[model samples]
Structures are given as C-alpha cells and as structure tokens.
Target: MSLQSSNDGPLDFVKYQNVVDGKLVASSNGETYHNINPSTLETNPEVPLSASDDVDKAVIAAQKAAESWAKVPWDERKKRLMDFADALEAHTEAFSQMLVKGNGRPPLHQKIIYDKLI
Candidate 1:
C-alpha cells in the first residue's frame, strides 16, 4: 500500500517545504536537495535545506510551544498526549508506508513499533 495525500498525491511526491510556526515554507536561502530513494535509486522531492535563519525561527517557535505546553495542567497534558497517540494510531498504515520508503524498514516492523507506542 502507498501513502497517498489528497493534495500531494503520494506522500513521497516532490517539491516539499519546511514547516515553521504552523506553516509550510521555503528555506530562507531557497536551498534544497533531492532525496535519492534507496529502493529505486530515483530522485524524490526537493527537500528544503534549512538555513540558519530557519533554525532560529524553528527554535523560537519550539520554545514558544514548549512554554505554552509547560503551563498546561498535568491531566490536560496527559489527555492531549493520549489524543495525539490515538490520532497517530489511526494513521498507522500511512505512517508504515512512509517509514518503509524513507528508512527501508518493513511495514511489519513499523506496525510493531506503533503498536508498542499505543
């Protein structure tokens, strides 16, 4: 099975972007590198080569999220985490497909790890 995205068609499809502050964006310097798929030795998406400015932006965003998350009550945090885990579990097949292509891990192996997480 393949991981298909409504917009991107396939999860492995090309022309990717960097995500910062809850948005998909390009590198500050507009640099990218195509990931060579090991199975087919084919070029994949032009993944962003994040610049120092992007690193700074990402760090700042992460810090803000961490600060807000730290203030949440313990029970609320547990509920949110459990909900996130459930959402991940629901997408196990797509995730397994992605891992198989990206890391060359078998789908079964991916399933096992996801199961353990839940």
Candidate 2:
C-alpha cells in the first residue's frame, strides 16, 4: 500500500530504531525484529530488539533526569506540554500513517484515536 503525506507528497521510506536516553541506540546484542507491514504483509528493516541492558540504561537515564524534570516550574512544564501538543498536531497525518503501517490499524481508526488523544 502507498502512504503519502499531504504536505510532503510521497512518504519517504524510513528505518525504525529504538530510542534510549533521548538517543537512537542499537541493541547491545545486535539483535533486531522485523516490523511487518500489515497491508502488504511485507517486512521492513529490523528494528532494535532492546535487551535487559538497554532497559537498564533507559531506566538509569530516566532516574537521572527525574530531579531536573521535577524542578521545572509548573508554568514552564505546561508550556512545554502545549508545545508538544502543537508539534503532534502539526504531524497528525504523518503519525496516523505511521500507526497504520506499524500497527496494521485502519487509517480512519488511527485518525479517530489521534483526534481524541492528541
């Protein structure tokens, strides 16, 4: 199935990866799992299969950031959340398509969910 972004025309093919500590990281074991396209039943490139080590790193990173995150002013935190909402709105279509491709959900259903959640 073809996926297109209204503003960007055809969607560019992208390889998925794991994000850890705000950075894209490969699994320590170099293991990956295929992300199968639901519609086409085609497998995309392998994405990182995060092992226990990766989870440990992620937890440690979150723990380290907890103090600063907790110290942020309420208003600033609200503003940051609003900014994030705006960013999600700007990319709604793209994100919806990603849901379809990644989760094999119908675009309409995904859009509905996005509308409610985002």
Best by TM-score: 2
Q: lDDT by residue for model 1 over 1-118, one digit each (tens)?
A: 1122334533433457877777788999988876665766766657889989999999999899889889999999998788777766766777666656666666798689767877
Stretches off by above 4 angstroms in model 2 are 1-13
**Tens digits of per-residue lDDT for model 2 on 13-106?**
4766666667767898998887788787977667788899888999998897787889999999898788778767887887888778888888
How far off is model 2, as Cα RMSD? 5.9
Error of 2 at 13 (Å): 6.4
Off by over 4 Å in 1: 1-15
Error of 1 at 14 (Å): 5.3
Considering summed lDDT, which 10 consecutive residues are worst modelled in model 1?
A: 1-10
Q: Candidates' TM-scores?
A: 0.76, 0.81
